[model samples]
Target: SIYRMNFAASLCKRVNIRELVTNVPAYAGATELSGGGLALVFRRWATKKTAGSTKNGRDSNPKNLGVKKFGGERVIPGNIIVRQRGTRFHPGNYVGIGKDHTLYALKEGNVKFE
Candidate 1:
């Protein structure tokens, strides 16, 4: 990068000494050196803007769906046993299923899958 900057400086000096007065140490001033000629060739080497993404990328919020209580785990009444999108696990004795198909406990006891 240093070599490229030095080369560009020298090239600019060779092209026009007046242009170098403001360009050195701060190429930001290079924009002033205007001429529809070869001096403006360095502009082509300047950084190009990154291409914007064209794909319609999107993502939905996580549902946080999963088992909340495993078998043999202690549970209180109304405690969620499983959170799922469908009837993955049927509600057994002392268990109940919610409108969203989530299984919950109906009584205080150790959770059982069967």
Candidate 2:
């Protein structure tokens, strides 16, 4: 009995899976309902997102979002630090920016935002 229990535990350890899930069928339901409370058609509804206008008169484009990477953060060669729409922060050694004002690292080093 102890040997069998140990064997089962070893099999469980060998098959070390974290989780298991079952695939669900969409857009379909049971044709015949056991409970007599099925009158309407069972279907999935779709949702839509609305992009409302801003109260401030400025257009939402070219937000000039600055500083993806901050000061003293370790970065590898060719890591994008920040993406912006304008020339907010200039590039230094081992750092560069694109034509669209996207700042990135040219070399592997610690980031220094100034």
Candidate 3:
């Protein structure tokens, strides 16, 4: 005789940068998860900078500044874990890995990953 069991699993909605920072528990600027997972975080702020003059010489709000990078160790559950090398981007936008890795832009406002 054979017995069968069915298990139901739920998927978590992917969270955007803003929501990831505010909603996730113990969320720091940048965090490395044990088990080969990485979290990139940032805050909202604005500033003005000087750029090429538009016929009239003047400074303007040319750039927006925000958190650039955060560092942490990678861990393995129930085992020894090591921090793998990685790279982060500015504007609290994206993360890249390995040489010649393609760049990804973060969603503007609250974004959800599937």
Best lDDT among the predictions, by candidate number: 1
8-108: candidate 3 lDDT, tens digit per residue: 22234454566444343345433444323344445555767868657866678844332222234222222211113233332223332324232233322
Write the residue-wise lDDT of candidate 2 on 15-57 in tens digits: 3122232233454356433333323444667878888987887
User: How big is the positional error of residue 11 in model 2, measured in Å on the Cα after superposition?
Assistant: 99
Model 1 RMSD in angstroms: 15.9
Better of 1 and 2 by lDDT: 1
lDDT of all predictions = 0.79, 0.70, 0.34
Q: Model 1 off-target regions past 4 Å?
A: 1-53
> Where in model 3 is the C-alpha error above 4 Å?
1-36, 51-114
Model 3: what TM-score?
0.16
Of models 2 and 3, which has the larger TM-score?
2
Q: Candidate 1, after superposition: displacement of residue 95 in Å?
A: 0.6
Q: TM-score for every candidate vs. truth?
A: 0.51, 0.42, 0.16
User: What TM-score would you give candidate 2 relative to the actual structure?
Assistant: 0.42
